[model samples]
Target chain A: MIVGERKPLEEIIESLEGAEKVLVAGCGTCVAICMAGGEKEVGMLASELKMAAKLRDMKIEVSEATAQRQCDKEYLDTLKDDVKGKDVVISMACGIGVQYMALNYEPMRVVPAVNTDFLGANLDVGEWAEYCQSCGDCVLADTGGVCPIARCSKSLLNGPCGGSADGKCEIDPETECAWQLIYDRMKALGRLEKLTEIRPPRSWKTSRDGGPRRLVREDQKA
Target chain B: MKSGSNLEKVFEKGEFALTGECGPPRGADLEVVKEKAKHLVGYVDAVNVTDNQTSIVRMSSIGASKVLIDMGLEPVMQMVCRDRNRIAMQSDIFGAYALGIRNMLCLSGDHQIFGNQQDAKNVFDIDSIQLINVVHTMREEGKILGGDDIDGKPEMFIGAAANPFGDPFDFRPIRLAKKVAAGVDFIQTQCIYNMPKFREYMKRVVDMGLHEKCHIMAGITPLKSLPMAKYMAKKVSGIDVPQEILDRMKGVEKKKRAAEGIKLAIEQIQEVKDIEGVDGVHLMAIEWEKKVPEIVEGAGLHPRPQVS
Candidate 1:
């Protein structure tokens, strides 16, 4: 899931300078699961903004509305009525959702209230860790299903560098060395020989190095 | 002789080689490199110029190598993947070769968090093994990574680092074999304070017959003080300073610790020299260049072998 965290209240408030009427929008998908930009968070942000405005002697009115998923146009269309007459739309969704909302409501400034962190999995209550980098190409099959591109601090394709000690990365004692995990997994599966093969230089073109990416499906196109 | 470098020539002649390291100054001072090279000029075959080691910004390895070359000393210029992409790496290779450098050491480099520039973005576009292959392809095939033919290839005696003390201890030898398969001509290991562990690691390397494929140089650094010994044992990653060595250092008087450190380093050199499959010793007198000659002489490795 796309994990995101709400932007600091001060920065969000500063972004709304000179706004008389504001709409605090939320998404019910990934952000909601992460407890960041769900309907409940939207209500809390709206009340806080109203209190801040009152304390500063500013004449401002804040409204709240949430969509099932802001990335989908059909779901965002439901908030059309709530968005009307608002000077600004504060999107409490991931970066993609903010951009989608801005595109759907052309000429309306849709500001992001959350910072999209990464494609990750929630390990526990309020604990999330990145799992993939969306690098168009994936090599999980060869690495015992461990994603070195995302897990390794250096994104090393070959075995662990000299920095692996006690199964921890040299960078931090808390972070587990990704290659060590791969080694352990491969050894458990009796596939240790697979690691002997040297991986060639990665074609970073498939990654962000190739620039902004787009997926085109001719079969699904109208 | 691969690159006809003095180091390669020494190895080709089946002579035990000796290399030294010289870290460029934090500022742009060629004099510092020359001063460091003076201590190692006649005492070693080739000098390794570190590239922003520990991620702290310093004069580039290539720039410092050119300084050594100007002083009539051969330099094994070190290149790290942490700072440059393929294009920049290749460009520097060409430039370094043009300036008379013939030896190169490829490394993944220390993380930037360990350096002064904690906020800097690292460019590990290629790891050390891939970097070794890149240099090999550029030299052997006369083609850049993109498959474009170059007018003149950088004929370098390529080298890579090995850390026998790194974790998943059983896999350390396998990593060395992978480097050998990647076309590395020589291997300089991380500093060895744990002789028993290093001997076991070498036994595995010898069993795999990787020793026949590339020259293996044991890394040696003198512990300047008890504090320095403790730092390496605890703080520095991948470096294993055995408890016995620390206890030995602790037994020495504070004023005599430096002497004890050099004596221990000399003892290590003598033991490593007798180890089968060990090719040489890379003396890294980090910031203590003046003591290199004494350490080399104390180890009975003085009057280095001469090879044309």
Candidate 2:
């Protein structure tokens, strides 16, 4: 899921420097599951902004609204009434949803309230870890389903660098060395011989190195 | 003669090779490199000029290698993948070769988090093994990584690092084999304080016959003090300083610790020289270059084999 966290309240408040009317928009999908930008968070943020304005003796009014998913135009259309007459709309969605809201509500000052972190899995109630880098090309089969591109600090393909010690990375002892995991997994599967084969230099065209990516699906096009 | 470098010549003549290391200064101080080179001029066959080792910003390895070359010392110019992409790496190889650097060491540099520049972004476009392959292809096939022919190849004697102490210990030898397969001509290991573990790792390498494929140099870094020993054992990654050695250092008085450290290093060199697959010693007297000559001579590796 797309993981995101609310931006600092001070930064969010600072962005509304001269705004008199504000809307705290929320999303109900990825951000909601992660407990970051759900309806409850939207209400909390709106209340905090109101209190901040009152303390500063600013004449400001804050409203709250939640959409099923801000990335979709149909879901965003539901917030049209709530967005009207607002000095600014603070989007509490992932980066994609924030951009989508800004594009759909053209000419309106739409600001983001959350910082999109990464594509990750919710490990626990409040714990998440990055799982993939969305590098277009995947080599999970060879690595026993472990993603070295995301897990390894250096994104090493051939094998672990010399820094691997005690099954952890040199950067941080808390972080498990991704190649160790691959080695153990491959060993368990009796595929240790596969690791001996030198992996060629990765062609990073599929990664962010290729620049901002776009997808066109002719089959799904209208 | 693979670049006809002095280190290559030493290995070709079946003489035990000796290499030293010198980290470039944090600024453009050629005197700092030359000063270090003075201690290592005749002591080592080649000196490895590190590239921003530990990720602390320093004069580039290529630039420092030129300085060493000017001082009548051979430099094994170290290149790390963390700071450059394929294009930059290839370009620098040509530039370094053109400047008379005949030896190259490909490495995945220390992460930037360990250095002053914690916020810096890294560019590990290729791992060390791939970097070795890239250099090997440029030198042996006269082609760049893109498979395009080059007007003039770098013709470098490529080297790569090995860590017998890294975890999943059984796989250490396998990693060395991969590097050898990738066309590395030499291997300089991580510092070895745990001789038992290194011997075990080398036994596996010898079993795989990797020793015949490339020259293997055992790394030696004399522990200056108890704190230094503790730091290497606890803080440094991939280095295994045995408890006995730490105890040995602790047994000595504070004033004599440096001498004790040198004594221990010489002893290690003696032991390492006897290892079946070991072909040389890479003594890294980090920031203590003056002590290198003493340690090298004390180890009976002085009057280095003058290979022409």
Clashes of each: 0, 0
Top model by DockQ, which number? 2
lDDT of 1 by residue, B1-308 (tens): 67999999999998889999999999997788888889886888999999999999999999999899888788999999998998899999999999999999999999899999999888889889998988898889998887899989899999999999998899999999989988999999999999999999999999999999999999999999999999999999999998999999999899999999999999999999999999999999999998999999999888988886
When candidate 1 is compared with the true two-chain complex, its DockQ is: 0.84
lDDT of all predictions? 0.93, 0.93
User: What C-alpha RMSD separates each model from the true structure?
Assistant: 1.1, 0.9
- Per-candidate TM-score against the hidden true structure: 0.98, 0.99
Give per-residue CA lDDT, model 2, range B1-308, as digits (tens): 88999999999999999999999999998888888789998999999999999999999999999999999899999999998999999999999999999999999999999998999989999999999999999988999987999999889999999999998898889999999999999999999999998999999999999999999999999889999999999999999888999999999999999999999999999999999999999999998999998999999999999888
* Worst lDDT 10-window in candidate 1 chain A: A13-22
**How far is A78's C-alpha from truth in model 2 (Å)?**
1.5
The regions of model 2 sitting more than 4 angstroms off are none
* Colliding pairs, model 1: none
- Model 1 spans with C-alpha error above 4 angstroms: none
- Per-residue CA lDDT of model 1 for A21-78, tens digit only, reads 9999999999999999999999999999999988988888999999999999999999
For residues A58-154, write the lDDT of model 2, one tens digit per residue.
Answer: 8889999999999999999999999988899999999988899989988788888999999999988899988899999999999998899999999
Which residue pairs clash within candidate 2? none
